[model samples]
Target: MGLFNRIKEPIFLKESSNAEIQIEKLKALKPLLNPEGQNIIEQDIKHLEYGIVGEKNIAFELKNSHMTMYILHDVYLEDGDISAQIDYLVFTKKICFVIECKNLYGDIEINSAGDFIRTTDFRGRKKKEGIYSPLTQNQRHLELMKKLKVDNKNNILTKFVVGKYFEDNYKSVVVLANPKTILNAKFAKKEVKEKVIRADQLVKYIKNMYEQSKEIGVSDERLLEWAQSFLELQKEMLKDYTDKYEQYKIYKDKAVKSIQKIIPTVEDKKATTIIVKLPVEETEIFKELKAYRLNKSREENIKPYFIYNDKQLKDLISKMPRNNDELQAVAGFGELKINKYGNDILKIMSKY
Candidate 1:
């Protein structure tokens, strides 16, 4: 079968090696637990079972996309100390879609800050609680994937050339797996509604998105190769988490991007290093800068490059600002930009 080859039925958590692995752990714990400990384990098992059911529900609904895309379920990816489990990852060569499934039920309200509020019935007693934000949960997945590169193309490529794909990559979704749930986020941003959708709306959303994504221009073989690489990474992560028997690591503090490789060429018995300014595009920094612009543009419904043009991008990269005062030297980055993105630009530069 091809990497995306479909079986008579979908390959979901029910078919996952990790599922079997997890089940065995449950079995092994059975004989050793006292009643109180068993109760705690049972609750953990219940949550696990519920999560798998959500994943299975979404996987089945995604079948209409099998012929055109690759569907992955129960993906666990570890980034350094952090373990990220994705319920469903659907993608084509040019476009990657992430859906974080929430098996939650009740009336859901999302505030502008992206906090989740759940209010529902418990034998008519009316219960309410706050759940962690799925938007942020899926955002972590998108960020980690964007950070992965065969090589840092940002050091040599144009943003539109290397980054158009990254811009689309962040457009992820959060699916409420239950049809009984009601979304009451009247104050949710327009972008939030665009991303978070109901289960029944998912198929139509993917089909529409796939249609729009048809122009990606990557070949089947290369695209398949790219996808397979991501899958290979996931397989490694599965073993990584399982053996971790120490327990999964929670990321409380954000880790800044570290410089993993440095670029230099030898000349006349000396090493000549090429400096990189990652905040400007049309230059080596173009891809990162361009993706940033695209993200900002989508948020405000403005043109992607409305902040700066090609010449300005080239100039900004060359200026290589290291701080607020230095940023003022880059063309088009006036006081407003210096105030708004100065810190962020410096941080991105620090990583390179």
Candidate 2:
């Protein structure tokens, strides 16, 4: 009948092309979303699955103090984070769990390296990237729970990687069937626990943890402040990367421009024009550019601009042979860079 009903009885729900199309549309909109936007949309999907599939009862626990919640969440100790903030916390009598909500799509694969990959269909092409390592992040949450001194040992403390429900999309929550699946995948486990549960059973523990934490103590403003700081730190770390990227771009442009003037070019400008991508994140491209520039006989006629990643390369690929603005986008190709190596890049490109 409906999507929710279909989950309860997958056979009867009737998979339609319309549902699949709707899910694809949602995926398209994911990138435009902010963190909060992304999180909410994901939660909506999970609830839809629960409604349709008759999921296990998930008890989440968080205190709404002054319209804010301070949640003791599952975390990874290796990443060294305190706890994650959660919205829904249900406390039931039997089981306990700290729910960590993730809005994701595709089958997740955990390998021997202790790394995780999320499978996504990018333009109908399957692509995977290393994402939130549940083992690492959740363990940190466990440690934080212990630090909080909650009587949770008597209760079950489990972590879940909830997959967001996309209408007609095959988004399934996959947890390693057992702890052995992870450890024998050859990664060391910080703690030895019995079997790891997935699907409905994980929800049961979440409900239990929520209920148990409620009896311990309600989270206070101090806890909220601490969570805020942690989130901020994550943002700050991201900002640092962005700033470095920007700096590299600015300097790279200047280097290219300076090279254009100094490097002697052939009369056939069109044939001489070529674009070479610079390496990013400690790759060989940086060294190659430097070495080539050093040995050039007519180094004055060459200009070189730096490029970091494929995305950066894609942007400049269209504007080959260096424009002022495009050159600016290259990191480390600053005015001094232009004065020194701009002609060198031009000379190299001219050879092509």
Give the top-scoring candidate (lDDT).
1
TM-score of every model? 0.60, 0.28
| 235-300: candidate 1 lDDT, tens digit per residue | 322221112221222221111111123545555555555443232223335667767767877888
> Per-residue lDDT tens digits of candidate 2, residues 301-348?
533222222333323232244444445434333344455556655554
Q: Which pairs clash in the backbone of model 1?
A: 159-287, 281-286
Q: Which structure among the candidates has the greatest TM-score?
A: 1
Tell how far residue 19 is off in model 2, in angstroms. 21
| TM match of model 1 to true structure | 0.60
